[model samples]
Target chain A: MAQMADKGETFPATVENRGGTGRIVLCCEHASNHFPAGWGDLGLSAEQRLAHIAWDPGALALSRRLSASLKAPLVHAPVSRLIYDLNRPPFSAGAMPARSEIHDVPGNATISAQERAARMRAIYLPFHTALHDLLAERMALGLDPVLVTVHSFTPLYFGKRREVEFGVIHDDDPSLARAIVKAAASTGLRTGLNEPYSAGDGVTHTLKLQATPYGLPHAMLEIRNDLIHDDQSVARMAELLTPVLNMGLAEIQRQAKAS
Target chain B: MAQMADKGETFPATVENRGGTGRIVLCCEHASNHFPAGWGDLGLSAEQRLAHIAWDPGALALSRRLSASLKAPLVHAPVSRLIYDLNRPPFSAGAMPARSEIHDVPGNATISAQERAARMRAIYLPFHTALHDLLAERMALGLDPVLVTVHSFTPLYFGKRREVEFGVIHDDDPSLARAIVKAAASTGLRTGLNEPYSAGDGVTHTLKLQATPYGLPHAMLEIRNDLIHDDQSVARMAELLTPVLNMGLAEIQRQAKAS
Candidate 1:
């Protein structure tokens, strides 16, 4: 990954396994908890900044393991979701949320329109544009890749505990998600289809914006953060998911060929 | 004004007083309660469709009077807010609200990504483009026009009575809003600065998105629906506010010259 030191931040977004020949294109939108130089913690305490609200803990690690296991290209954001939630479109309040869950983000409360646009220019646009270009390049190379985004959610949300371990969420098209669910049925992991969070929760924006337009099969994988807290657990989760993703891909390909 | 009946709706956005010479550009975003042919009432009853939830009552009439009174151009959305709230940026939940106040919009609950983009293309884009082109043309003609968006709110919100009849709301720059409040002081109108709804309420999206980038003086004028329920009242309200608006514009210009 190349870092632009002059931009006051690391790489806006980074690509790993760029030459991977797998039929899957991976995205990890909440990869980093970095606040950059000028943003100044977003009026958040150090603990709060490091909390799940800043970034998905271990999500980048899990995504990296998956990228290696699936031999897929991975694109990830390099700043905190507090800076700009990459999944949310520009101008949506959630894009630069003033509040998230139980915590108040004082820094985001009074952003000017010009500043909003500037954040989009510096962060959101570059990341999405890079992913779009990669997708286009893959299409040009006749890869016909399936889009799969990796994310992690906190086990306790607003003091409530979540029992679901894995979620396969879809926006409109559920082909890949269904296939993954079917493939995951053999495993002991408690997987739910459109569960924990659904498209109705506006979590599938990445799938909707990037994949639906191109008719690419897409799904968002949300792992409960407790399951992948450590490097070993992340690797184990990747090991468990890798084969299921492969089988899902195989099943979809088989169906496509049959049709 | 032009109508594209072939597209199964009226004019996506209508512009009045296109050749007006005033240095103010007025916008009525919630100008219509029209649900296009395909979107059947958004699963709302006839009464609910006609209610303020669908569109701001009497806002267009007041805007038209102001357009004539000030000899300023007016650009307005021609579809119900149920289809797409022109004031909200695309992808926002409020753009195609699943619920407004006590009403649940069954039709908008599970929109596909393609459908969302389609609505943006059909409604939001055309409206904004028309307004943007108008502003660009005005700038080209050396008229540094002020933007004034007209809207009307229900007197009762969520069963709570709102006493403020007029709200001069701003996003960041409060110059125009402050000026309007100052000018409205002489009138008997119950005016409030950023009252009823403020920038924090996400009510100033039009001003933020359309005007802020160009450094245009902008403010949103919100009138209580009870005061402008009839055409006569709308005309009278327009008459009362017309001079206030003129005085506000004069004050801003005078301040500008003094600076």
Candidate 2:
């Protein structure tokens, strides 16, 4: 019940606020970069800690901007990615990240069962529980909230340079993805279809487990990490994305109403 | 921060700890016999509240017994089924019951977005967050805890009497379901295939979200409501399930190691 920020924390793993009267609910699963005290910098140098492994650097900023512009409620996880990756299922090999690239996570290995549960209860559950509650509240009000997950993908994985400017990945709700892609292309930004990661990959959470189940109009919007590393770039991306998202949301609403 | 039950009114929900080494976790999403704190006995006499609409009457008892016998942790949501079904997705219409058999949920009509999110955040999130944390902790300790979800079904639904004595349901993990069926049949109990519900129903949560993602062995064991209505019957059901679950866990471990 203590405000995480009051403890001098950087960002709460989960935060929810009404954006506007619109029926869209925004979520950023990997939104923070601060680890709790005592994890001891994840056994990495400061520079290494700031790398993609620690957090999705630009996502939180973009999500904040989107939340402000779209006037939709935004919910995000606050703990550092190093503590526990909220996006990954708790059991995935990547969830605890025994190893990331060349860095070995000393604190993550051989964690006690109690410790694992503690972290999950502390971080993962609160974030998701908040999101679920927010969505449920929206629905109970006779409003269907379109789920928009904001994320940033590193421009490169391993050592290869990627070329996707933007990507829309989805498993079952291709309609929303298609609309976003088409809307973005109309604006001259090249979009990738499931580039960086595929929804088919079993490694997804929020979307598959939460969104798809409710048949909510949802999309996993992946912006190149390089493009969102700074505030200006993040703003630019959000600017371009606002209309696309609006278009998609409107279309989905039209379909829902017609049906 | 504060204990929910200590609030004096039982928080209208309950949390049950089925004692175990915390190696295996069990959950019953629909495990309460409640009707909003105010409905003055829910517009029906005491007999009506006792119906399946108010709670999965037989589930909590069986879940408690299973958790105790197997030394597994059990997490049950303590709200009335009529308030918000935890098993149903937050955005799904099924979440707020409009009508159930003979009685209607009077307090559930015309809820607002904020109120809906509050209920979801308050109840559903806490229950799942605990489960997620438990599983994460076990994995961190290098122990793959199997998740067993327990529930009970009425002998009839919408007006038909069910005939099966037991049901083992799974989405992609047929091996565990098959093993349980074989184990149960070996003891001469008549088991049904995905009876009462189907893995494909899109509403069942435990198996699809938790079990499937963790790649942990799981089975949704459904016993007829009448079959396990009391402690003695719950204990007997647990006695019959222990060997089957042990076998399933062993097979899962062996297969996990082999792969």
lDDT winner among the candidates? 1
TM-score of 2: 0.84
Least accurate 10 contiguous residues by lDDT in model 2 chain A: A1-10
> Which candidate gets the maximum DockQ versus the true structure?
2
Candidate no. 1 TM-score: 0.52
Cα lDDT of model 2 by residue, B97-194, tens digit: 66776566655555555555555556655666666656656665566677777888788787777888889888767777777777676667778778
> Runs in model 1 with CA error above 4 Å?
A1-259, B1-11
Clashing residue pairs in candidate 1 (N, C-alpha, C atoms within 3 angstroms): none
Candidate number with greatest TM-score? 2
